[model samples]
Target: MILWFTYILVAIAALGGLLCVVLGLAGRRPSDLTVGILGLLELGLIAQVVISIIAPFAGNPPTGSLLEFWVYLVTAVLIPPAAVVWALLERSRWSTVIMGIAALAVAVMVWRMQVIWTVQGS
Candidate 1:
């Protein structure tokens, strides 16, 4: 994994999470803004997936257990869509909060993936 891209993903996810949290706390239900932010986060995750696929061929193969890294990557890619679906169906302030939590979770998971890719050994 590229270190800089990881940082970018974390930043986007963290900021989006915080924004959703604040909106939820302000008594808002899920909105287009929240969904759009999640959509962007999902796009970033998809890009990360592509990069991970290509990086090994480019001579940046992960030092960690490849299975572990792939598992984390796949799960991280799923979170945003899951949260968005939940929010859409629930349409409650708490659902917005759940989306925030999901985004925050993705940020942490992405960071873990970075550690596994760059620091851990198989």
Candidate 2:
């Protein structure tokens, strides 16, 4: 995994989590901006996936087992869209909570990716 890209994902997730907290505390519904940020996060995740795919062929196979890598990749790619869809249906502060959960999950996934890479490297 690319350290810089993982950092970018973590940064975006942190920002999203902050936004969710602000919206929840203010008793406001999740806005388009929240969803937009999620979209941006998703884009970053997709870029990570693409890079992962290319790296191996470029003679830089990822450190993790393929199964572990795929699990992280699929979850990272799916979470934002799933969160957006689920949030849209709720229309409450809970939607923000859901977004928060999604952000946290992304953060965890990035950490896991790092761990997987490190374990493989050793």
Highest lDDT against the true fold, candidate:
1
Residue by residue across 55-109, what tens digits does model 2's lDDT show?
A: 7787766676778877987898899889888889987888877887888788888
- Give the TM-score of each candidate: 0.98, 0.90
Minimal lDDT window, size 10, model 1: 113-122
Lowest summed lDDT across 10 adjacent residues in model 2 is found at 113-122
On a 0 to 100 scale, what is the lDDT of residue 109 in model 2? 87
Error of 2 at 113 (Å): 1.0
CA lDDT of 11 in candidate 1? Answer: 97
Question: Residue 71, candidate 2: how far off, in angstroms?
Answer: 0.7
Tens-digit lDDT track for model 1 on 13-89? 99999999999989999999999989999999999999999999999999998999999999999999999999999
Candidate lDDT (C-alpha), each: 0.95, 0.82
In model 1, pairs of residues that clash are none
Q: After superposing candidate 1, which stretches have Cα over 4 Å from the reference?
A: none
